[model samples]
Target: MIRALAVVLFALLLAGCSPQVETDQARLCRMALPALMADGAAIDILAETPDPDGRGLAVAFSARPSGPVPERHLAACRFREPGRPRESRDLIGLTLDGEALGEARLFALVRYWLATPEGRAADPAPLGDLTRAPVLSRRAAYALQMALDGLPLAAIYALLAAAYSLIYGLIGRINFAFGELAAAGGYGAAMTALALAGLPPAPLLAAAFVMAAAVALGWGFATARCVFIPLRRARGQQTLVATVGLAIFLQELLRVAQGDRASWMTPVLNQPFALARSGDFVAAATPMTFVASGVALGVALALVVVFRWTRAGREWRAYADDPLGAELLGVSPSATTARAFALSGALAGLAGAIMTASYGAVGYALSATLTLKALAAAVVGGIGSLPGAFLGGLVIGAAEAGWSAVFPIDDRDLAVYALLIVFIALRPSGLLGSRDPVVEGLRQSRS
Candidate 1:
């Protein structure tokens, strides 16, 4: 495992190095450095030449004061000289102990790069040995830093994905408006906290969090009653279209109401949670997260209690199995469907509120995209499985955050869709979707 990891690290290191075909310093001098450095200005490379053909030598590329430095001329500058006495010259040494380089030593190297009559010939030689120490040291430090930072980012993604997976499993469809719900919850809590600016942290946080969660739950109830129930009863392609339309409408309404502006959901308990390995990456759970978690737990507990202990729970299970039969026995399918929608929406709103706090801002136009991602999470985790929805969300969140940190890949939106497609191909029924008996029947019938 260690060897494999070492190989991967080596490959990444090689990738970061300047490509052999074209020198980075040449490009910088011709286009970049001239803009910053006055003519005759010189800078030392902290390390040896990165070029394979011109390794082992300290590189110094400087230009004479004047017009644009031609690319061909810049490229032709010599890298380092060969077989120089590494011990005697002290040409490659750096002062680490706050000891400054004497004027004579600095002038000697500067004059060398200018290649004036005062300095030696600008010969392109591989570095001797002293240059290698700092080069390897700096690279090792950078790689270590990245590895440490990456661990928590990965953990954050896992957490969010798990939360989304739970939501998808229960809802059976992506709540396109889910992100907004989280955003709203977060913003509402933040705003409330701001209103009570002088209050103690505990009470202020509680008040804001409660308001956010309550608002989300209310919205969830309304969506179930006003949008989802009617559409589900219609039980046609129009139902899907209608839900999508509602999502669009909600997003537009929020945009228009807010005048299409950016807003921040400021932190309540602004204290940072520090990690030992990476002191830089500090985060604290927002009030919204606490509210959402409470809501999630309460709902789960309610489901367990109702299902295991109550008459209503047994009837609901029967309804799920056979709606027509349950209705004939006087269990109302309409009521059950309405309840499901309310639950799904409420949880989604809670999540949205949390996101608002996490991001520290919210915008109207982002709702539809949020829904799409939530759906992707649900699908990836296993559609109609609550645990799966939560897991899916975390996976997507982590993947997105992690990729941006380590890679220079573009178009994150495209990556999410690609991931969804791969998941579908690998597990068509989703994480918890049942195998289609009808598909088998059709095959048998055809055979």
Candidate 2:
């Protein structure tokens, strides 16, 4: 494992030598084809032409004919700037390359591409023949491809879920602020990457994670000292409310520090490497994915080992199982709770850094959504079950990825929520949970 990790780290170090800062051209290509005249979903005849200068993409689409006269449906996201590759970009220009094209010019350009003998498809068809392979190669490739793409997401979620489980078990209250801590961690990693741009790739990447975790640990310590410790004797609802407030406060702090919009960075070690090959398709992941996965899993494994075998782990488990019983048995509730906060916070922070490295974007707004998802993952896996948390994260991440490909993109979030509801209704104890946590807690209280 160490040898394989060394290889992945070495490769990443080499990748940092290149222009890790993704250019506008690379960003455009990252989202879609540089230049493509393909059929689209909403627009009948869709085409995209890239600006050679790396400015943006010009899109043109003609609506399918409703009658003898063709209707010109309004095309959304026809022109997209490199800055906002996902959103439609409309600009007034006539550059040599298609930096930005107005409606008329876009339509004209599409006509020129499709009408001209040089660019247009021959044989009396606007679209050239697209053949399907008999092996179901594309479908198989797609499923595997989604699984591969989801690996990093899974790693991040796994870490987050583990953190949630740790805190929930230790204190019997959820740390709603974990998602904010993750966002902060990502920001820390990004800032570190920018500052240490002169360093070698491997060191830079390592420093980023270290700094991110350190920062998060520091914050976690602060929250423990100021918020959690003071309320150690309080009820779960009070602690839960306190954490929610902390989450909100952290979000505002991060937003003020980083700003409203998501800060983008050049991808680190994002150059894709092939995982598997089908007839014409290849599933791939970057060196960073390997690095991220290794690091996240290592952290998780280490945590699990500590929880299972260490003296500290035993004490904490004792407290979580029965606070009064543990207090009577010589365990200090104060110390155990404090350590749990620090450890859980650090885990969440590392997950954020992984997100930044893998996705190349981070913002304060990510906190709420991430918290909800990770919480759902924790619940689905058995909220207080350490190992189950990691497993749940893997399941949730893969589910999101699979749903995106198999179903309409719009309904993806809904699916996760639905799954959460199903798990709660059918099996409140979760996969690894031996009994329903609520019922168990009540029984313990009575005893």
Candidate 3:
């Protein structure tokens, strides 16, 4: 495994060093530079990079003869189609002297540069308004857009939380490696899709899901058998600490195998469905989002039913409620624990596959954040309650989406944890949770 990972990493490093291909933006900038300069002046455009503000390009160039260079020079060129009745209005421009330029400056420069009689005659309306084109009020559309975006994220969180809750409730040990299991599933699906690129989408998708679930299941079983089972006689905290190390090991392994760059999944069910439209403002949901959320909800419901009605689920509940008693009643502890781990991993893998498909990419960095969020959801939803986990995920997702509109992107996680803290302080049982035994015991001890 180490040798295979090393080889993959080496190949990725080689691919990154391969020759660069010129993009359309680069081509446009190159073509427009000559028009912006003096008629016969020799100028060479050397480098162009996106400005930090994302408004325009930062361009570097040197004028020939090496004479006194101006501290600042700005020019814009509006390229027009030669034979078209309707002229093309796209503008490209540069600001020299190590300063970033705005779109407004680019538009203004184009208008001023084209002020000559012939230039004006070629295209009238050179000083087109650069301000935002009029659109319906975004305020009215925010709620719907938030719902469309948040619900899918909520579904993903719920799936992950379910996985966490299942293993923790049954084993009384938190499996920190579950997130890596999900990442493994994502990589599995991505690899399978790449391997079977010639297959039709339906079959390919089905195969990818199977591959993802199988990979995660195997990992979960091995983790239980090799790690947790061996430490079964030890304290739960010891097993938890071991799982943390295991999580780190798995993450590093994936980083080596998959490389640092994100792996993009095939675009499946990604067509956008516009929910509401008023002028330029629109609320939309992609088919991918809907499909993923639907699958997550269906899976959650199915699991709920299985736990409530099935014999295997009864065995699981029996083990969770009282492992010693269950073992005495002829339930195989190792088999039950393995089954729990497998189911949890399968759910996590399914979630990962759907999430990667919806977002179109997966990376090693995603594992830690996803695990944290799912763990938070489980705790907030009353850790052992399946319905509560789903509800908690929705709450977290909605809170994040809504708060992002008001706060900086970097502060969004703070809002989630703050909410969790508030909930814990006020009601340790969570929204749907019964009184927590740990908290109750503490209170009784204090009394």
lDDT of each: 0.49, 0.71, 0.69
Model 2 residue runs over 4 Å out of place are: 1-136, 436-439, 442-447
- CA shift of 71, model 2, Å: 51
- Candidate 3: worst-modelled 10 consecutive residues by lDDT: 79-88
lDDT of 1: 0.49
> What does the lDDT come to for candidate 3?
0.69
| Candidate 1 stretches greater than 4 Å from native | 1-175, 278-316, 436-447
**Tens-digit per-residue lDDT, 1-447, candidate 3:** 999999997885464333221122333344444445565445554454543332334445554433466322333222331111122234444544544347776565446543334444432111122122333457767677777888767877888888887876776667888788889899998888878644434566678888988999888888888887778678426877899999999999999998998998756545354666555556776656776777778887899899999988999888777776788998887888888888888888887887787787888889998898888888788777778888888888888889887679799999899988988899776777767575334323321
Which digits, one per residue and each the tens of the lDDT, describe model 1 over residues 1-447?
999999997875454333222222222122222322455543332222333443222234444445455221122222233211222132332222234346575445444443343222222221212233233344444454444333332222322343344333322333455555545554566667557644444565457657876776676667767876665545335545766676677767667766587676544333222222222222222233434344445555665686568876676566655555677999875677565555555555455545554555667666656667767766776665555554565567656655665676587768878899998989876765556674334323321
Best by lDDT: 2
Task: Pick out the ten consecutive residues of candidate 2 with the lowest summed lDDT.
Answer: 121-130
RMSD of each: 17.8, 10.2, 15.1
TM-score of 3: 0.67
lDDT of 2: 0.71
Q: List the pairs of residues colliding in candidate 2.
A: 79-89
Full candidate order by lDDT, most accurate first: 2, 3, 1
Point out where model 3 deviates above 4 Å: 1-140, 198-200, 436-447
Q: Order the candidate numbers by TM-score, best to worst.
A: 2, 3, 1
Against the correct fold, how does model 1 do in TM-score?
0.55
Between prediction 1 and prediction 2, which has the larger lDDT?
A: 2
